[model samples]
Target: MTDDARELADDVQELAEAQRQHWQNTYTTHPGMYGEKPSSPAVHAALVFRAAGAKDVLELGAGHGRDSLYFAREGFTAQATDFRPVGLKQLRRAAQEQGVAARLSTVVHDVRDPLSLPDASVDAAFAHMLLCMALSTKDVQALAAEVRRVLRPGGTLVYTVRHTGDAHYGAGTAHGDDIYEHGGFAVHFFPRHLVDSLADGWTLNQVHAFEEGDLPRRLWGVTQSLPQ
Candidate 1:
């Protein structure tokens, strides 16, 4: 690459790192950001697991454990991990309050770093709205690898991510950049091609793009059953 291109790439990386730090600070200051209850996607994902006979599930970037709580309520053994300490604390409290202690475990983990789970340790893995906001292509790829590493062979990966062509860009999101600053932090956006590219080794069983009402949000999901 030319020196000019390299310089621009460095600038973008620095901006993305700033944005990531901002989000970490936000969750640290306000654990309630994930909401008092889980969202519809979380509930829907939980039901899918129950029907699939998946008893052991691991959720990556389990902010505040909203979906984890839902999974626990449904009698699934759910383990969730996030990088933020405050969010995990709130999640633990919420689980105890919701009577899901028997089915839930929370771990402090950063997917960008090395993962500590043994291979094929989980029956299924879920990533909800976590694919976006990656700092770079490498971070995006690492997130996928982490999910693949933790799942049992033939395990299911249920992922929901924001669509790149959705109308929400530039209003509160960065546009034309690999990553953008939002609410004091940087967020990465992935076009469909990039999302699929991250799934390089995983068997792509299905890919669906859906929108609800006038929410101006699009979800691009891929369902993959891990290879044996």
Candidate 2:
């Protein structure tokens, strides 16, 4: 890699570590920051997956496994992964308490790395607000490739991301490319074109924008299908 390229790679890694640490500390400090209820996107995706006869699900950034537990209770076996072990532990406890332990499996996997699961395995893959992390455009493409690799032919993938219109989009300190270091964390806000680029080579099904959270974070909800 050229000197500039190497420096950019190192910066991405540093930012990722900072993000991981921020989330780990947030979960540890406020165990219920996001609460136990299933998110809107997850609920909708679960219904859509069930309608399509999808039985196996792979969830990325499965924070506290809130959505994973929902999938389990809905009769889908879920592989929930997160980079933070603390979040995974909380998920395990939640699963047992919720009586869905047998249906849920937790793993400590970072989204930046290629998925270890075999190709064409999961019937569907789901992620909630994972796309808005401090990931560069190139990293998003890599992550999409991994998601496609693990999904079965014609498998569905549903994800959510904060849009550039979000209240916090330009708040705090800016990092180039619409990313900003905010509240001791990094958020990479997405524009409409980025979403289109990411969904390239796939069958983009739905594109909807909605506002949620106290800052009422603006987000784009997307659903895509891998070609058979």
Candidate 3:
């Protein structure tokens, strides 16, 4: 690689490590910070998964697993992954408490790396606000490919991302590639074209706009399916 390319790769690695530490500390301090209720996108994804006849669900960035537990409760075997082990521990505790331990599993995973799952293993995948993390455009695209690799043919993917129209889109420490860090949290606000690019080779189903949280973050709930 060229010198500049090497520097950028190093920077991305440093940033990813920093963010992982930040998340670990955050979950350690806050514990179940997002509460037990599933996000609106997750609820919608469950319905879509059921309609697609998906018996198993893979959830990325499933911190504390609110949605994972919900899916287990709804009768789908759920595999939840997050970079933070603390968060996954909390998710495990919650799953046991909710009597869905057998139906739910947790893995500590970083989305930047390839998924540990086997090819065509999962029936559905869901990722709420994960693709919009501190990932570069390349990293996000790689993650999309990994999701596709794990999902069965005709498998569905429902994901949510904070878009360029959000209030915080450009209001932070710019890391280039549309990524910005604010209050020690980095986000890669998605542009419309990025969304369209990610959907290439897949059947784009819907792009529904929605808002959430006290800041009322604006996001798009995207659904797509692989060709059978």
Candidate 4:
């Protein structure tokens, strides 16, 4: 690789490791920080999945299993994955306490890597504010492809991402590729075109704008489905 390309790769690697460590520390310091209640997106996703006759749900970036646990309680077998083990540990504890351990499972996974799931194994997938993390445009595209690969034909995917219109879109240190670091957390604010491009091979269902959290992070709730 050229010197510039090598530097960019190194920067990406460093940022990813730093974010992982930050998440670990954050989760350890504030266990169940996001509370036990599922996000609104998850609630909406459950309804969509149920309407589509989905039985199994794969959740990416399932911090502390709030949504995954909710899914299990709602009668869908849920598999939750996150890059941080601390969060998953809390998730497992909560799952057992909630009596959903039998229907819930956890995996420590980073979205930058290929998902370790069999092809067409899941009926639905959900991700809230995950695709907006410190990922490059290419990484997000690859992750979307992986999600598509692991979902059954006609399977549904419901994901949410903070878009460029958010208040913190250009705040803090820029990491290029629309990624910016704010208070140690990196985010890749999505542009409209990128979202449209990712749905190229899929049936674009809906893109609804919404806000969450105290900051009221502006996001788009996107739903797509593979061809049957």
Clashing pairs in 2: none
Candidate 4 regions exceeding 4 Å error are 1-5
Model 3, range 8-70, lDDT digits (tens) per residue? Answer: 777777888999999999999999899899988989999999999999999999988899999
Q: Locate the minimum summed-lDDT window of 10 residues in model 4.
A: 4-13
Q: Tens digit of lDDT per residue, candidate 4, span 1-228? A: 999777766787789889999989999999999998899999999999999999999999999889999999999999999999999999999888889999999999999999999999999999999999888887899999999999999999999999999999999998878889998999999999999999999999999999888897999999999999
Q: Flag regions of model 2 displaced more than 4 Å.
A: 1-5
What does the lDDT read for residue 216 in candidate 4?
A: 78
Per-residue lDDT tens digits for candidate 2, residues 89-118, read 999999999999999999899888889899
RMSD vs true structure, all candidates: 2.9, 1.3, 1.1, 1.1
Alpha carbon lDDT of each predicted model: 0.73, 0.89, 0.93, 0.94
lDDT of 2 at 139: 83
Model 3 TM-score relative to the real fold: 0.97
Question: Which candidate, 2 or 4, has the higher TM-score?
Answer: 4
Native-referenced Cα lDDT, model 2: 0.89
